[model samples]
Target: MKPFTKLVILLLSITFFVSCGNADDDVNFRLNTGDGLGKGKEVDECLNLGENDLILSIQEQFTTLPGKVSILFKVSDSDQNPISGLTADQFTIYEQGRNDDCFNTISTSESLARISPNSQVFSNNTLLVLDLSNSVLSSSLTELKSASISFIDNVMPDTAQESFKMAIYWFDGENELHLLNDLTISKEELTMAINGITDDISNDPSTDLYGAVIKSTDRATELLNASTQGDKIGAASVVLFTDGTDQASRFTKDAAQKKVDEADPNISFFTIGLGGEIDTQVLTDIGKTFSVFAANKEELETTFNEISTRVSERANSFYLFEYCSPKRDGSGENNLAIQVKAGSKQGAVQTKFDATGFTGGCE
Candidate 1:
């Protein structure tokens, strides 16, 4: 081969290898910016601690004038099961400035970092819908009431907070979704409402399961819209319990499913079915988030408790993590990463925030 041709071929090979190397680096350290409340971008510059057993998804983040940085995020395991009751002590903050090659560890104690209440920026609402048809009212009303009270006890916090609230609604053959109790933070009020349910409460013998699903989804959408009107982020759950299929035929199954499908993404649907008469497939579709079944009334409370546990975990997963940034006004934008350690598992997420006006009076 000619000398010039040999040199050209060698140059092309080197260029191709270099391009492949850059592509591999991009893939290895790719960053993901999630959507909605879990909104954050991963930082490629930060060190990878290890295989993440836990996933920290940032919902929202902001900065205060006096150098306080606030980040709201949800924690879940690799299986997507939420991890709750995590304290600020479990978190470690790292910040990277323009001059730093990587993140610098920030002292949690020195930064006055803490996990604050999310009431100012986050809200979670739950709508518990019950079936009061003839079958349920006559045969399983007592068991249903007991299970519902257990659900309330398990889901509600010991102390009430404005950010967490629940409302109760019941349905029968009638087209209306009757309100058993308005939204309240008091678990006692919810339990009392459940206990007040009597066999005579439903005059109709038919069941409007589809109607109830539609109405409850509408109510949940309204609540989400109201909660998110300002700067707050909101989430809701619709937990519906029924012992049988829809009998009234007032609404089509497709309509109910469509309502659930088109509802706000922030709203989650959970359904509980009891006895052999219920259709598991339909309930599973409606309860896209989760669905539980009980072979008979004997297992009702346990099934309700399972759903309550999930609801509570989901609500508690959101953390309002705040800390005083060491960055000054001229620092421009800095890379921030939060690592959380829970038992044997750990995970981290990274994002950027401006410290253009940051100062030193954080509380």
Candidate 2:
């Protein structure tokens, strides 16, 4: 090869490598300013926290009368697993005004920062669909009831909140999806409804698994639509438990899978299967978010618990962080950064808020 040709090839290779590296860095460091909620825009002048272990995706942010700023966001680890139970003390608020060279940390105590309830603007619903066909009713009714009660205890909060609720439903060979209990925040009500299921509850001997999937997806869609009225944002989870495949064949597998694939992104699908008769592939496909299996009835409770942890974490990851800003009127637009620390891992997100109207009293 000629020396000129070799030199040209080396230059091209360097250019290609540098371009790829730049693209990767853009994706790795860019923060996500969420859509579909409130006013959250990208801040080009904001500081880059650079390769943190946590991600805080700001969904909605707004300033209320009298200088209170509220930001709603979801917290997750770098691996995308939700981080729940973070208190206001874990957060450090920093603000930079037009006159300041750098951001100044605001004292949490003086600012009266708090993690308030998000019920006014956010809602989370879970639909627990159970398979009570003749096989499960006669063989695993006792175990199913126990597992369901444990699920309710683990998923429901100790104190009831209007924003969080769960509903129970069951399916058999029949063409209908029977409602065991309506959506409610009370765990006792859900537990009682599950405990009341008897062997005679399901008259059909076959399973209409596909039909249940389609119907439950429809129900979750309705719940999400209803919850998202006015300025509220909502999310739903459809959890299905089955012991066998679609024996009735009333609905085609393709139809069921398409429903799940085309469903809203905010809605998550989860499936729990028991015994050897269940099809792992179908369940895994239907439960795109997560899936768990139990080889026997004895392991039913454990599988339910595993799913419970995920559902709870997803619901608790969202936070309504509110604080009083020190910047009065004429500050115009200022940069704000929120830093969260969980053990050794820490992450920060930066955005801007306008303080057009000055205020003194903020609660």
TM-score, each model? Answer: 0.87, 0.87
What's the alpha carbon RMSD for model 2? 5.2
Q: What is the per-residue lDDT of model 2 for residues 71-128, given as tens digits with 9 covering 90 to 100? A: 9888888777789999999999989999987788899889999999999889999999
lDDT of each: 0.90, 0.90
Which residues of candidate 2, in runs, are more than 4 Å off? 1-48
Model 1 steric clash total: 3
CA shift of 69, model 2, Å: 0.6
* Alpha carbon deviation, residue 329, candidate 2 (Å): 1.5
